[model samples]
Target: MRGEAGLPPVDMSVKVGPLALPSPVLVGSGTFGFGEEYAPYCDLARLGAIVTKAVTLRPREGNPGPRIWETAAGMLNAIGLQNPGLERFLAEKLPPLVAAGHVVIVNIAGHDVEEYVKLAGALDAAKGVAAIEVNVSCPNVSRGGIEFGRDPAVLGELVRAVRGATRLPLIVKLSPNVSDIVPLAAAAMEAGADALSLINTLLGMAIDARQRRPRLANVTGGLSGPAIKPVALRMVWQVWQALRPPIIGMGGIMTGEDAAEFMLAGAAAVAVGTANFVDPTSASRVAAELEDFCRGQRINHVSELTGGLQV
Candidate 1:
């Protein structure tokens, strides 16, 4: 398995629960659009997986003006989960992705338990959907976003409902705005989640000091990028220690070293988020860099990096 540049043969494939990824790097939902938005800039099929934007039961116009605000090391977004709904995604967006031979993971959000179940069942019949990332934590939405995610009972119920709906690999995406993430992580797993993705943006806001107003129309938005790396890493590490499920660590993953750090912190895989907005090919590049990282460390398989942290 000698890699490109004739370095030591390194294996990047990882088992994300029942899903086997060819690489440890994946594109985070929302940031990568419908998994094809960045295809013009990079090869979507090259990455381990692509998590599509938050798909809902109906179309949403998203939030009002100034949905995104740039900060020091990160950005705040209150996109409001605007999407073309399931029918449109299945009819128009999904075909090209499946045709491109890429591993597609559809991420869905809902205002209630039944919505999640319904959406899951709908995506189940899609041809190329490799998995479903349940977005229980979305700061942008008002009804069923972070509200359901913060409550262990609600989160468990939602996971269970969605689990019963689809046979696709279910990955519960957890929120970071909770007091104890361990319980929530355990709840999802106990309710029958095959995998987990952690730190789906922290609740944050930016104030326009000059105008004496909020930077974003939604006032508070989900914070992501380098600023949230430490928080994301800590949560992923805690969840991995507690649940030991296949975890996809995301939030502030911008480079290959960052992705490697997530794996070392106990993530089976890592997703590129805000970095995609900065560089469309970030995910693919991270995958390549991870291979070089393994070769440099004399590690033959990338899976060895999971929970490899000495401390």
Candidate 2:
């Protein structure tokens, strides 16, 4: 609808699975830090949603020293999903998040199918938890690692079991290390995932040639940043062509144009990750820039960018 000035007020709202968001820009888990770290940097309520770092049934110490390393165009980290366990998160972090008025989506990880179910059930009862993002694609863990995200059949079972355990919207985060991502996406949706977040992180490593040692203590870590943007867009486009579920496209989104590229490639929304390290308000910046872009292009709404790519 046009505003008082007659130009259409860009509608940035988007629905992913069952959750409705005010804007299409969300902060990726791990980077945003439960919405508290950046609360002063940007308005958390202005974002579509904030996905917290992966929380487990038990607290994790994460990986050893040198867990993060900077590369040419991106950074690699094998932080190993360090997070306060679900119980502590509920007792401490969650209340403030809700009180701060931010829409929260808890990202959960598990060592096994039963663990996933247990986490889902527990989070379902937590107040102020908007949804659950199943972190099946972390490459740093020894148990239940990327294996759960790589196998189509196994992923299906996991999703189905998680579905049975919770009533909240389920978003199965997909791994980019797979041979083909389409089948993995299909399996997740078929197993009852309400939405999907694609291209978690590409498996990569940085080495110190002179020292003959890996830059990261874990030797390898998930690669994220502008380096993976093209790969992410391709996968989002592939899944968008074959699936009807909303996708939270993420990987190397650093700017408004990058987010728009993902949207045009078929993402219902985009998540900002690595850029957060450079600027805490990257998500809000992207959203503001996106609106400016829509105005310049005469696009009535940002949602029109979704799947608007032409051959």
Candidate 3:
């Protein structure tokens, strides 16, 4: 029951490039802002790592009026990557959490490739940023998002540009909006991504039948939570087969069993995003259950379960 340093041994310790972790139950970026908003409920140290909200090149007011509209299984978000920008996030937001003792993964976005490089270089030298996750899937953004992600060449170029800018490990957050995931993942890995996180969200909408109008201000919002699970799992398996990089499987994970399914599908690690919106302590609880299941299955290490499935 005891591990190194006499700590309680767990089965979910995973890896991201050179950084090995104590668990694979991290909360997703964008949903969790700067790693402090949900602190009242869960211990930050219990997660494999914390991916902060998406910070942009400049502060954005985001979309007008209503940004989130509840759907049957998941919520549609048109938050538009509203953030404090890199300067504010590093100076004001990340410092305090850096001292709080957790691996910090900063999710970042920009309007252009140059902006991405600039932000990447700044975060690479940042005191607390353990890694940078490129948010290529934010649909509401004007540039450096879907335009780049929709095409393999553009996505590769954007990732390579950011990779050249920073010494820190890069985790490219891939979009499910693309047609073929194989070409996309292959492009990212070839362009110098240390790891990849799938997926951002599937494009969806909501309609108020009584009013005969669209619900979200943007009309269309990225669909996250449980609704996108099946597609996300398929992409994870495809990308794992194509490139074989460290894959962070996410999208619609709500239970410990769901997290286990991601690992079985070839995810090196799993992230809980929209599920956090549903259950405040979902990440920690999932971690505990994952460990317990590992013990029951007689699996000594969680890493042994990665890609356990053939198809």
> Candidate 3's C-alpha lDDT?
0.85
Candidate 2 per-residue lDDT over residues 1-311, each given as its tens digit: 32435677888888886789889999898898888889889867768888999989998989997989888799998999888898898999889988877788999999999989999999999888899999999998788558899889999999999999999999999999988999999999999999999879888999899999999999999999999999999999999998856999998888899999999999888899999998888988988888778887888878899999997
How do the residues 192-243 of candidate 1 rate in per-residue lDDT, one tens digit apiece?
Answer: 9999998799999999899999999999999999999999999999888877
Query: Candidate 3, residue 37: CA error in Å?
Result: 1.6
Q: Which residue pairs clash within candidate 2? A: none
TM-score of each: 0.97, 0.97, 0.95
Give the per-residue lDDT digits (tens) of candidate 3, residues 1-311: 42444444655678866667779888898877877778988767789999998888888878885789888788898888888888898889989888988888888888889999999999988897888899888887566577878888999999999999998889999889878978988888899999999899899899999999899988898999898999999999888877778999999998887988888888888999998888888888888777776766677888887889865
Using TM-score as the measure, which candidate wins?
A: 1
Candidate 2, residue 80: CA error in Å? Answer: 0.6
Candidate 2: minimum summed lDDT over ten consecutive residues — where?
Answer: 1-10
lDDT of 3 at 117: 93
True-vs-predicted CA distance for residue 158, candidate 2, Å: 0.4
Candidate 1, position 155, lDDT: 88
TM-score of 1: 0.97
* Candidate 3's TM-score: 0.95
Residue 145 of model 2 has an lDDT of 55
Rank order (by TM-score, best first): 1, 2, 3
- Looking at candidate 3, what is the lDDT of residue 64? 81
What local distance difference test score does each model get?
Answer: 0.89, 0.89, 0.85
